[model samples]
Target: MSFRAPHDGELLKSEYALRGFLPKADPLTAFPCGSPYAPLDEIGRDLPSLLYDKGFRSYARGLRLPPWQTRVSVETLPLLRLYYVRIGFLASAYVNQVGEEPVETLPGNIAAPLIDVAQRLRRPPILSYDGYALYNWKRFRKDGPIALGNIDTIQNFVHMYDERWFILVHVEIESIAAEILAAIANVKRKLAQDANADLNRELWRIEGAVRRQVETLKRIPEHMDPKLYYKTFRPYIRFFDGVAYEGADTAPMQFRGETGAQSSIMPMLVAFMKIAHRRSILTDHLDDMRAYMPAEHRTLIKEVAALPDIGAPAYREVFNAILDAMASFRRVHYGWAEDYINRRTDDPRGTGGTPYMRWLQQLLTETEARRL
Candidate 1:
């Protein structure tokens, strides 16, 4: 029962002070995208209950392993719930964004100001500490059955802390989605031009559809102050296993939990691209991610993939751009790793043990080799 003592707690406070952890509004006030089953804000209400009920029910009916295993599964439900909130919010946001405009209408000239403002928004590096995940939030509740029993509890649980990290992650999601949509639009435009037409009706339709989605990102709440998030909330968001580990003491620590790697939008985009191309390498990883998405968003993505003339000659170039995006994302996060993990821990494990990091490198390498 020995914890890391005053050092970890003191360090957390100091770091929070140093980083300027001030949130202007509640992070839950930040929107979730639209869902058919629920409103945009409450889109993922049923997830926790669904997962818990299904998981134990399935275990009961089928693979009855060990009692401890079942307990482990129950214990892990909160983590799954938290993950769903983070990612489901993104999917819901995207869905709501798509709903802002009808696909039948042409994507009008998006104002320069909108694009400029979004472009100017700073993208922060992914920070990792061993403590954020360590605190079992479920235990913090009074009537704690170690499960997110209802939507109200789920709502309260997520907003219990400053969720600036999730907000930042949402920013990345929108930015990356916008980039991909732009690339798709460019491809569509080129295809239209090649067909000896003044205006490609299909291209306009595609542009309108993608543009609506991209513009929705612009509506993501601006409540998160970057300085505040990094300084205050980020430090406390650790990966300590609660009882056994209390997390690090000093500034800049290695990332805890696989979520630091898994929940990243770039990796998910890369996964989607691979799946579209029928690449089986990361199917399991993608499947795990799929659980985080709203059902409609998944259907929307499928429709995007099936768009006519998407796999044209321009597909290679667009695909290469996507690969580049994934590489660039890795580079940024790697820089954080270098500063936090490598420099602090003195372990040169950048892109070494992390499967997602290695996957990005391998994918890039294979892509370049194919070009050669």
Candidate 2:
């Protein structure tokens, strides 16, 4: 089903429900004027940065405060370390393919082999929503962290693949993929458990809980808008950057810095195409493998091979179109950059007066150009 924006009343109702109290009568309304349910400054630090507390005198002052540090468990730490390694390897592969200088910290040349190993070690596991289970349940949750404070509106999941299909891949890949996810999840879960135990045992639980409540109070009352959520959350979305590339004689090598939507959209487009090709090859091989089988099994194998090439063609076409669009978009945006600088004394956002907004405008221009 297509997404529909919530009405203001719906947003307000959701916020009220999530907070576990009526809006006006809630203890959060008391603030500094009365004995607050929790301390204001302490709570401000615990709340998500996107939210603002109505009671807080200065958002800047709140921002300047030190953030709470949660203890990381050894089990969880290793998983995080592995995640970093995976990211490094992926980055390296991209860079190597692009024929560029590899960054020292990232695993520049080992990405493909590492990912292959990961794929081999995979297993299919049931998706769980347990907070203590780890692996970022927030990613799978219907309402994400954005809904924590405001409660009125929830952000939709914005993963590149369809969740159901992606889950199916895990099932198809089975054991290896499942094991990888469980390993990661287990680590995160243990870490959170350890942290929580430490907080409780050390008599810090009261302080932490109070601080969290206070911060919750301070956050902006507005429901999260999807566009705003995307803009704010874009940076945190993982993209492997700064891997070295080995030169290739045949393939075109293009290197460009990407941020915002392009950073994610580009890599996803590339990965989707690569996966499509792999699936096609696998399907073909499965067909060949069937030829050696008994007549009954052979028929079954052919049937499997004949299953529609679901995403391969569509993803390939979409990616190519995006690339074509990007080329024209880059040219026009660069043109605007030149024009804007010529008219202005100082470059705002240090982008020569044409930031992402100009680039996006150019993308629209390219789309129109394509229509012509």
Q: Per-residue lDDT of 1-372 in model 2, one digit per residue for the tens?
A: 111121122212333223211111211211233322123324322333312233322332222222112234543333322232233222323232222233323221333333332332231010111000111212234344323322211111222222222222212221112222222223223333442211112112222322333333223223333233333322222223332323312222222221222111222222212222223432343223222222322332233233222223323443344345434434544444344332443433221112444444444444335321
Show how many residue pairs clash in every candidate, following the order shown: 12, 21
Candidate 1 off by > 4 Å: 1-176, 182-283, 308-322, 342-356, 367-372
TM-score of each: 0.35, 0.21
Model 1 lDDT tens row, 72-118? 24444333323333332222222112113211111111111112221
Best candidate (score: TM-score): 1
Q: How high is the lDDT of residue 348 in model 1?
A: 27
- C-alpha displacement of 208 in model 1, angstroms? 18
- Candidates in order: C-alpha RMSD to true structure: 22.0, 22.3
Instruction: Mark the 10 consecutive residues where model 1 has the least summed lDDT.
Output: 1-10
